[model samples]
Target chain A: MQKTASITIRRKFRVGNLVFHVLVIAFALFMIYPLLWMLTSSFKPGTEIFKSASFLPETWTLESYTYGWEGISGYSFGVFLGNSLFVVALVMVGNVFTCSLTAFAFAKIRFPLSSFWFAIMLGTLMLPFHARLIPQYIIYNDLGWVNTYIPLVLPKFFATEGFFVFMMTQYMRGLPREMDEASRIDGCGFFMHYWRIILPLTVPSIITTCIFSFIWTWNDFFSQMIYLSKIETYTVALALRQYVDAMGNSYWGALFAMSIVSLMPLLFIFIGFQRFLMDGVTMGSIKG
Target chain B: MNGKRREACAGYLFMTPWLLGLFGFTLIPMLISLYYSFTDFDLLTPETWIGISNYVKMFADKKFVGSLGVTFKFVFIGVPLQLAFALLLAVLFKKERRGIRLYRAAYYLPSLFGSSIAVAILWRRIFNKTGLVNQVLALLGIQGQNWIASPGTALNTLIVLQVWQFGASMVIFLASLKQIPTDYYEAATLDGAGKLRQFFSITLPLLTPMVFFNIVMQFINAFQSFTPAYIVSSGTGGPLNSTMFYSLYLYIKGFGEFQMGYASAMAWVLLLIIAAFTGLIFGTSKNWVHYD
Candidate 1:
């Protein structure tokens, strides 16, 4: 009788588990339905896109991809992609170098008024970008740099992103001071100590900073919109906006195709570095 | 120099780039933006000191007030709804079940792309009259309009987009949820408490701090939400300005129309508004936020 009772409980447990799975999966499917719909609809010919609610394309075609790649106004979409990658690369390098340099100081050096400055840095993290945006634009416009990528890339070199500096500082604080002492004993000066010893050890933080900077820069539209005007200089974000505004809904298939192409790099990064992304998000919240 | 002074000097040297950036970009510009708020500084024309005229004009301007209302509505409605979805889903997914990681990734994927222009474009098309939403509506014998193009449903579409990306907040909530000691749950279970009861008495109390954090961060974020409104509205914030998000409006005024002084006033007000909300949350959080 006890065995029968145990069997009955096991059966009930299985039923509950099945229900949980079904519910969880159903919700997940709903969450991603829009995205999947877009992906499938991109393959459908323009006329077929609105004909069915189904995710599967009645007849898949490469027409949209080819057409979107040709781009509008005589510039290819490849130019936009290249421009985006270029900006992301520079921004990544600048943020890493500048944030690390600043972070190393905040983390290790006991500078006079360092805490005061560090506090101010943390304050900037909470600050809305709108606070300085107007003035920054004015300044950039004064420099004759309004329509160039300079406005987008240059500020990053000065470690304008306080979040990374704080993140790297938090990471550097946990690293052993023995490494610093050893470097000092080895007669390494300040530059050597930071460049050779601390930086190599802060690889994880560096990676996190790079991933974030890359994503943020690539996805950045506000500054891109403000600064870039010419078709030749447009990043993916800017060009995509221009494409939609210029083309309207007349070319829905090509629009979706272009949208997918734009998301591909971010998609790869998400798939590959998802764990790091989660770590970055949690680290900011938990520590702050 | 003495060793301590020398070390301090080195520290300053290391911080030079950030210090330069702080002064050149954040600090001085914020000061200038504040200064500009008092003047009629349209880029094409000479900036003249106007003595709070811009601020006064902002209050009187119909479009300015409308945009502010839209922004407030978006912030107040979108954030709380998103947080509720976040906490609910976070709690549901907190269990260490089979394929949990994959589920988490799948859920988190939308958020990673949530604020991007690409997804914003997808949002624009997906809610079109002949888009997927309408296609699905027809299956139920229900007709659908272009949700984004209609003032009534336009802002709601943006809100749904906000809620759809609840995974970002869920990640934060999930992290905190995971940090809650299992021993607490074990103790509750020993006292004959079921999962639902333990969740309320133990879980909810422990989750308060996270709730506060997510609300503040997400509110700030949602308030500044631009790309979706810009893309969905085609940067006009239109269909009778139903989706005129503050930043979008500010962008149009400042950059589009060269209303620098007025937009600067709007920008300063934006800062105050964000600060006020943050302060409000921080003030109230003392009562309910549990800390050990």
Candidate 2:
């Protein structure tokens, strides 16, 4: 009797496990379907997108990709892609260097008014971008930096975007301060210690910051739309918007295709460094 | 000779980039906008000081009032609904089930493309008059409106789009849920508590902090929502200004119309509104946000 009851309990547990697995798989599929639709639709002809259809493309073609890449009203996506890449690269570099340095000071260095300054920095996070938009526009205009990538990349160098600084500061706070003390005992100066010890050890945080900055800068449309005026200077985002005009005849297939292509780099980076992203987000929550 | 002074100097030096950027890019611009709010400073030539005229005009502007209403509608409605969905999904996936990682990644993919121009374009197509939504409606022998082109439905579409990107909040809640000890639930069950009762008695109370955090974050993000309305409405805030969000309106004033001073006033007004809202939440958070 005891053996029979144990077998029944084990069977019930197996059933429960199977049910949970099935539910999880269904939810996962639901989440991924939109992305899969975007990818598959990119390969389909413009007319085929609307046809109520299966997941696989019946008549797959590369025309949309080709058109999306080469055909932006007398200025190919190559230029736009290059412009975006350059801007994103600069922004990433500036964000990592400046944000990490400032975060280090906030996290480690003890000085008079440090807490006050930190409060001020945190306060800036609450300041809405809309609050300073017009004035910043005027300043950029006066500085003759309008219609350029300077506005996009320069603020990053200044730690004006506070989210990254905050994240890095939080991460840096959790790191062992004993490491800093030990390095100091070895006659290491602040810069050397920061460069050789702290920065290297903060790889996960750095990756997190880099991925975020890259994606944010890459996907940034408002700032890009406001600043970049010339067609030659347009980011891929701006170019995509400009591709569709008032006549309602957008290159839907090509647009979707380009969308997938544009997302590829970010997706690749995200998948490659997903562990860092997950850890960073979790750490951010704990700090909050 | 002085180690303290050297460290102090080094700290300030390390902070210089951010400081300069903040002061030059953020602080100075903010101050200038405050000053400009009282002036008629068009970007063309010089600032013509006009005291409170811009503010008075803004008060009478119908579009400003309408956009404010639209923004409030979005924030008040979209935020709670999004949070509820996120929390539900987080709870559902909070267990150590097989393929949980895959589920998490899939849910998060929307956030990756959430703010992309491509998604916006896709949204327009999906909700257009002859779009997939309409086709689905046709299958049901029902008629569907042009979601993007219709003023009534445009903002709603954007709200749905916002809710669809609940992955970030879901992830946060999932992390927070994991931090809750399983023993509490087990104890509740041992005490003859039902699953629902256990959730309310233990899970809900413990999850308050994350809920509060997500609400504040979502509110701020929703208030500043510009890209969807901008892209979907083709940067015109069209279909009779149905989708003309506050930020988009501000953009039109500053960039499109070149009313620099007036736009500055609008911006300051928006800042105050957000500050007030955020302050109200923070004030109330003490009662509901359980830290420990």
Candidate 3:
């Protein structure tokens, strides 16, 4: 009787486990189906995009990719990709360097009103970017910085991205302060302590900042729309917008093709540095 | 030189770029926006003082009121549902030992590209009358509405999109769940506590802090959601203004209509509302959100 009861309990547990696995698999498939559908649709002819229910292309073709590469008006998709790359690369470099600098000051340095300034930085993080839009536009217009990558990448140089600064500060705070003291005893100054001791040790946080900055800047559309008006200066996000004119004909096939193309670099970065991204997000949450 | 003095100097030097950016970009624009909110400056005209007329007019403006209601509904409805779904999934996934990493990456892929133009457009396609969603409904022998184009379901479609990208919050929840000491569960099991009881008594309290954080962040994001609505609605927020998100309407007012002064007032009001909500969340967090 005892042996049969134990067997029954074990069988119940197995059933529960199977149910759990099946549920998760079903949800995962649901989560990924739209993306898979979009991918297959990109390879389908323009007329076939909406007609097919299956996520596989019945008639595989590369015509959409060619048409998308041709781009709208005179600007090819290459220009948009180049523009996005240039902007995202500069912004990523600026964020890693400048945010770390500010973070170092906040974490290790002894400054007057340092806590107050740090609070102010945190405050800026909560403020909606839309609140600053009109005035920032006017200022950029005055400076002739509108329609330029300057508006896009220049803020990174100043460490205006408070999230990165906060993340780096948390990372820096966790590091051993003895290294700084040890380096100082050896006649190293503030910059030397930073360059030799602090910066190298904060590699994880730095990489996190770089990966996030690249992805955010690459995917950002609103700011790009606000600042960039000319076709020549359009980023990938903005360039994608040009494919779908609200009042006119929309090149859905070309749009899907180009979108898939545009998302490739981000996917590559995400797949490669997913651990950093996950760590960054979770760390930022706990610390913040 | 004294160590304190030298350190102070170095600190100030290090913070120079950020301070300049704060004053130039954030602070100055804020002040200018405040000034613009009270004026009638529309890019072509000189600044004319209008006092609280813009604010007063905001209350009377049908579209503004409609957008505000829509946004409030979106935030309140979307945030909790998203967080709940994320937590549920996180709880389930925490125990799974095999292929978990691959599952996580797959789930996270949507959020990575959630706000992109491509995804937004794809969302529109999926919600169209002849789209995949309807096709699936047909398979199940149930008719599907034109989800994106219809007034009744447009905003809900947007809400579904918002909830679909809950992977980030799920990650946070999973992290928090992992932080919960296993000894609690072990002890509860020894006491013959069921899974539901343990979850409520142990997991719920411990996860509150992370839940609060996700709530605040997601609420803020929902309010600021522009790209998806913009792309999905083809920049018009049409089908009877069902998906007229606040930011989308604000964009239309400021950029499309060039109503800089009115938009500035609208922006300040949004800032105030968001600040109040954030403050309220933080204030109330003391009661429910256990930090330790």
Judging by DockQ against the true structure, name the best candidate.
3
lDDT of 1 by residue, A123-168 (tens): 7877888889999998899989977889898999999999889988
- Alpha carbon lDDT of each predicted model: 0.87, 0.83, 0.87
**Docking level for model 1:** medium
Report lDDT (Cα) of residue A46, candidate 1. Answer: 81
Residue B188 in model 3: lDDT? 98
Candidate 1 residue B200 Cα shift, in angstroms, is: 2.8
> In candidate 1, residue A97 scores what lDDT?
96
Residue pairs whose backbone atoms clash in candidate 2: A158-B18
- Chain B TM-score of candidate 2 stands at 0.96
Two-chain complex of model 3, DockQ on C-alpha atoms against the true structure: 0.72
Model 1 residue A232 lDDT score: 93
DockQ (C-alpha based) per candidate is: 0.70, 0.63, 0.72
Candidate 3: stretches off by over 4 Å: A1-12, A246-250, A279-285
Worst 10 residues of 3 chain B by lDDT: B95-104
- Give candidate 2 regions above 4 Å deviation: A1-32, A51-56, A279-288
lDDT of 2 by residue, B40-107 (tens): 86677798999999999998999988889888998888888888888888888888756778777777
Candidate 2, A1-288: lDDT as tens digits: 979988997798898878877876786776566667778888888777877545667899998899888856588888988999999999989989999999888887876788888888887877889877877777788899999888888788888878878888887788897998999899898788888988988887788878888888888899999899799999989888887662246467788887888888878987897776543263443445
Per-residue lDDT of B31-134 in model 1, one digit per residue for the tens? 99999999998898889999999998888988889999999998888889888988898898898888788788888888878888989988888888887789
User: Candidate 3 on B1-292: residue-level lDDT in tens?
Assistant: 9988999999999999899989988999999999999999878778899999999999999999999988998889988988888899888878657778877777777888888888887898889888889999998999999999988899998888888888888878887788789999989988999999999999999989888888888898888889988988988988888889999999999999988999999999999999999999999999999877
Interface RMSD of predicted model 2: 1.8
